[model samples]
Target: MRLIDADKALEKISKMIDYCEKDTSVNGLTALFQVGDAIMDCKTVDAGLVKRGKWKFTGTDKNGDVYQCSNCELKIGLDYETNYCPNCGAKMDLEEPE
Candidate 1:
């Protein structure tokens, strides 16, 4: 379970945004936006991880729904389900808990 470097992720996102601003291709811009979103999500997750402690990131809740950032592969224990990866902002594909 590797931890995400929030500073690096944010820096990369900034660069991606700059490139998107100059890019003219619709497809390229769309791709950049996706990447940017993931980075932002990663930043948020990292912050939480740092504030809460390492155990929180790795521990599973009673419900057994683990939180993971697909883009950065940051896994954490979460009590509830979320639509996006807190670490990379990627849309979560995990099945909903019953």
Candidate 2:
């Protein structure tokens, strides 16, 4: 799974929605709008999770090779190996380096 910052994701999704609105093609607009809606929902849920203390916002390296929990600083390498930080039980929602 790919992780991203909630606010950034939301912003990107908004831009996608705007692009979709401007598109004249039915198929492309429909598909992009649907994908944007799904992404917005996921980002909203992630934000809620963070606010509830169930998840922590973290960052990944440039190559998306590493994830370090913001709450505990525990490093995670394998993307599919786990979902939560072992040290703090913080949900892993890692934003890629920009």
Best by TM-score: 1
Provide the RMSD of all predictions against the true structure, rounded to 1 decimal.
14.9, 14.4
lDDT of 2 by residue, 65-88 (tens): 565566676676645436666777
- Report clash pairs, candidate 2: none
Q: Give the per-residue lDDT digits (tens) of candidate 1, residues 1-98.
A: 43677687877777777776787564765876777676656633343432221212345667676655645677766766566666666555544348
**Runs in model 1 lying further than 4 Å from the true structure:** 27-29, 32-98
Candidate 1 versus the native: TM-score?
0.30
Candidate 1 local accuracy as lDDT? 0.60
- What TM-score would every model get versus the actual structure? 0.30, 0.28
Residue 56 lDDT (model 1): 21
Clashing pairs in 1: 38-88, 41-87, 41-89, 42-87, 42-88, 57-76
